[model samples]
Target: MTTSWWTFGLQTVNFLILVWLLSHFFWRPVAAVIERRRQMARDLLDQAQADRDAAAQALEEARRRSAGFEEEREKILAEAWREASEARSAALVQAEAEIATLREQSRTAIAQEEEEAARVWTARAGELALTVAARLAARLDGAAVTETFLRWLTDKIAALPADVRSTLGAAGEVEIVSAAPLEPGLQRRVGAEIGAALGASLSFSYRIEPDLIAGLELRTPHLSVRNSWRADLTQILAEINHDERI
Candidate 1:
């Protein structure tokens, strides 16, 4: 076998040219594409980590806001309860004061009514007594009654002190009031009896008053002697009224 040196050398040169072409075109471009893809993946992973941290911070802030809102609600409720209690106490005090005032007014009104009733009953009793005395006096003998009253007057004057009798006689006139007119003889007798008791001469005046109710009244300027049924009945009624009031 005859070996050709030139042919071997030409083949070696062609292989070297093909190697340069593949390195400059297909190999360099494929390596560049792979490197760019790796860089993009790293950027995406960093962005995902930042997003997770921001989400955790937002959740913590939301929890703090919720706690503050709950505390504010509790404080407002306590204040409202305190205000309501104070208002209730004030209303009760006012109501009690009003009740006390009303009770006092009622007591005063009751006392006044009792006093008025007592006065009315006393007036009625006095009128009834007066009527009964007048009727009894009408049934009696006027002359006999007048004589008895004159005798009583004479006795009363006799019982008086000497100084009192002298004072009564110094009035210059002795008035004799009766329910009916006296006869001239009876009048003269009464005058003599009174003069004997007083130990002095006195001017006499006889007068008729139907209201005397079968009795006599001897009057002086500063002294009077009443011996009459009407006057006795009035005194009794006054005593009874005073006792009832007590």
Candidate 2:
């Protein structure tokens, strides 16, 4: 190598100039651009974080509102169910009361109907008994029955009170009523017996009544004495009717 101090010194000076130029222009500009880009990236990250926080807060608020709505709906449904149950119970109670009332009414009606039926049957039995007695008594109308009744009449007249006998004797005439027509001889005997019993000689008139049913009756304007099967049957029927009423 040929040593050249002049060439070496010149080269060294040019290198120094180049180094200063690069430091002042290129390096400074590139460092400023990088710093600016880093600042912008930090600002963008801060904005994104803020937006995410706000979105999370909104989601929590929506969840709280949904829970409140669900609770309200449940409360309304429970209230409606309770009201329906109360209504059903009231209806059942009313229906039961009505059924009991109807049953009581029916029982009362049945008892009344039974009482009426018994009364009607009792009346029918009384009528049947009276009819039987009347039919049987109708067969006993005969001379023997008449003669017996005449003797009883004489006895009855003989036992009369003093005032009754006086009243009979003072009457215009005695009416002799019988179930059958008497013979003239019997009539004379009956008049004699009656007049003897009354201790008076009395005129007499005769009349026949078949309804006496085998007995005799003494009648005046104000007094009547009945001794007949028909009268006995009638009295018996009246007593039976009185007992039933009691």
Q: Which 10-residue window in model 1 sums to the lowest lDDT? A: 1-10
Against the true structure, candidate 1 reaches a TM-score of: 0.58
Model 2: how large is the Cα RMSD against the reference?
12.3
* Model 2: how far residue 5 lies from native, Å: 89
Would you list the C-alpha lDDT of every candidate in the order shown?
0.80, 0.75
Q: Which whole-number lDDT from 0 to 100 does residue 114 have in model 1? A: 73
Q: Considering every candidate listed, which one attains the maximal lDDT?
A: 1
Task: Please list all clashing residue pairs in model 2, or write none if there are none.
Answer: none
Deviation in Å, model 1, residue 238 alpha carbon: 1.3
RMSD of each: 9.2, 12.3
TM-score of every candidate: 0.58, 0.45
**Per-model tally of clashing residue pairs:** 0, 0
Global Cα lDDT for candidate 2: 0.75
